[model samples]
Target: MSAAPVIVIGSGLAGLMTALTLAPMPVVLVTAGRLGQAGSSPLAQGGVAAAIGVDDDTSLHLADTLAAGDGLCDAASAREIVGRGRDAIMALESHGVRFDRKPDGSYALGLEAAHSRHRIVHVDGDATGAGIVKALVAKVRETASITILEDCRALRLIKRDDRVVGVCLEGKGPVAARAVVLATGGAGGLYEATTTPLGNLGQGAALAGRVGARLADMEFVQFHPTALAVSAPRLPLISEAVRGEGAILINDRGERFMADQPGQELAPRDVVARAIAAEIDAGRKVYLDARAALGEGFVRRFPGIFALCQEHGIDPARMPIPVRPATHYHMGGIAADCDGRTNVPGLWAVGEAACTGLHGANRLASNSLLEAAVMGLNAGRAIASEMTAATVRLEPVSLPQMSDPAPVRAIVSRGLGILRHETGLRAAICALLPKAGHDDAAAVALAMAVAAFARCESRGSHARTDYPHKNASGTRKLFTMDEAFAFARELAASQPLSRTA
Candidate 1:
């Protein structure tokens, strides 16, 4: 709390880009884990999606994005992000990010699933996330206006008369600021096995709901169809680039299953993931075979995935790598405009935390980094453009204390996981409410429960067998805190009580 003009939560690509874009404006970056430990950005294998190739255009890129989003993408937002993709990539280059280049000295673009062209730009092949993060972190360190506070978790947002003024931290004290940008990433940790950092437990989305911000499409949790199937606590991801390079999805029977699908091995992630889930349920193991497709080039091109696969006793060049669907990204989050403005004034969200209508129902491959860079800069510019020197004094909002996290974790993992049903969801809501009592953890659980209950239809990542049909209209829904609470109460009243405090 050094009287900075802006307080940014999380230090991923979005947070770091936002802070850096607001150069010379005193800003403080607070991270839950070490700056780079809590985000999925650094774990990204495929690169950012941009219209950099001579044959590629924004319209084509937009079409690819909309197609991957399953007809729910906001056309305007998709066009805007796609149009700016090239510029965003160039901006990163200006910030000293070294991308991979071909022998001809131009960017070596790679293809990914659901994209019609070679638009994914990487660095060191599969280490795009690490490379981009490394550059941004270096830039942030040299900037005098940006102060880095590591291992500081945001407990709750501080509000006064519907305007966010600051946030309460777990370890560090409260940070008062003129503007707050949430870039805490996605809710992958809510699942038992996920590719995202273990600390990304949807706190940002929950905090926004508590502060009365509108949340959109919370049901669209995107599960990566090919995370390395291992017993590790945090499952590692085998990049989609492997498939992009011609790897085939096979079952334990040595059958190539993806060939039966529309896009084959390059289908939208949801389709691929659901197919894999079905195969697994049928007692067949899914594998990503890249031996014939990549040969020795696999090791050189994707050293990160190669090393990880090697550590797990699966040689990418020799054997078919075991894979499974794991919670990877959340397509829904706090509803924000293109500039990252939330319903609450002075509160902005970007990257995975903000639903900018870019991803729609499902996110396209490698488009995440592009969104982070573009939206981060947009949010940064928006905050800087509306700078105010008037310091508004505000009373602190009291948060209820919590002692245990086990019960909350269990509730989230069981009820609101990869698969959902009305019975379990209702039971989860009933069990979580009393245990939450009046604590902040309970407040978060309540939001999740409410969101899970509202999305009755099986769409995107939220698969509800009870409500199996996909909503035909594909209309995106946004919920305010009051709406969520009311729905939760209604659902709670209808269900029989299983537990009472």
Candidate 2:
């Protein structure tokens, strides 16, 4: 094994921040693509959320976060994450990110759905993610303590005694490190439609599951409401900030249907996504009407969305954008504390890959960047406090064979996309569990279906159609991969092959 003291297995905000915070400690960063290309962070259009307003306090931010989590958020974790918001903003600024400022010299905060106050910090009006990543990548490249390997993929965790001692890379082989941080991002690619980068197939979660780490909230995948309905692998994302700026959703009949609903156009993502799905399912086409609101300034203020629209041959100034729901983020992941400590010792996770209970069942808009920065810093500091290098031996490894993800992706899109049902979920699992032997995503897909199947009521982003109500009381479920598979096998045994899960 290569003798890097610690190995971070991604190059997004969390991995970069973790390495940067570790400072003098040398860490190896392994990325599957270029430094900022394949990561979901670079594709984020909404800004990071922070309570930096005089009218806003940490308590309000905490309240909003808990409210969005749908009774599943860990109070302490939410407090710690939201409390550290200002410092995270300062830290990002120190790394050379310039947030948009108002005329009076305070931050130009924007409002998103479900937030009671204006507390979102952005950059370049609509290119917050790109701006943040650009600054961070510059800082990381200049730092002498970090070594980067582009196009190197981390395949599995190398555990010696129930603890991750190193990571096994695809072609570069295993790199040994006592502390391994899994900052690999979400699994939105598990479905046919997504706003996430195409490679975000929950590899980190699957690896953690294989190593016996407990996963939570697998059923609560958040779908964004306004992905452009184009025939692309990843649909172009129309930022939620536009809705905050007064854009309204309309169907083919030019009717603003969301006007009658609570929160109007600015409803929480899950509610809006469900509404959009209902429209699409009823053979009605939904559109985002920005022409009347932003008009000419739309092209200037939000060049990213404008460029996307123009590139697709539709002018936002003249016509509304066709829209539909697509998988955006996964709220459930490898359950971890704020320090990013997983159930397995020597293994840590942060960013979208770790379920820190801050997002609960639904992620408040723009809170993901906040989680990545705060929790990444916390993980780095925690690891720095306990630095003891030990000699480790490298073992030969073999990767699991994976087939084309399209078939399973189609199943996930049908059964687990926006709404879920018992029969459809059972069919998805029954189709996937057999294919699980050849593909890793199949297992992750099966896990999600089983988790959705187990939770017999709707809560937050996980809406079960057959069980169309929220349970009176239920805690987050923590289960192993074996347990999920066992449940699948049992369900398959209960019925005939033509009707079984």
Q: Write the per-residue lDDT of candidate 2 for residues 1-501, one digit (tens) a residue.
A: 345588898999988899899888888888989997777998888799999899999999999999989999988999999999998999999999999998999999988999999999999888998999999999999999888989988878889877788888888777788699999999999988999987898888888888888888888899999999999989999999989989999999888989999999898899999999998889999999998899988987789999999889999988999999999999988889998999999999999999999988899999999999998899999999985776798878887665688887888988887788988888888888887655778878888889998999888999988988889886787787778888889988886356323
Q: Give the candidate number with the greatest TM-score.
A: 2
Q: After the best TM-score superposition of candidate 2, give how far the Cα of residue 14 lies from its true spot, in angstroms.
A: 1.0
Q: Candidate 1 has which clashing residue pairs, if any?
A: none
Model 1: per-residue Cα lDDT at residue 439: 51
lDDT by residue (tens digit), candidate 1, 1-501:
235479899899999999999988888898877776569888888999998888898889999998888777888988888899978998899888999999999889999998999999999999999999999899999999998989777878888777888788776556678899999898877667789876776777777888889988776788899999999988999989899999999999999988978989999898899899899999999999998999878889889999999898988898999999988998888899888899999899999988988998889998889999999889889899895743755565555464465566677777876678887788877877665445545555566667767777776666788988877764888887667667767777876667631
Query: What shift in Å separates residue 24 of candidate 2 from its native position after superposition?
Result: 1.2
The TM-score that candidate 1 achieves is 0.95
User: Number of clashes in every candidate structure?
Assistant: 0, 0
Model 2 lowest lDDT segment of ten: 492-501
**What overall lDDT goes with each candidate model?**
0.84, 0.88
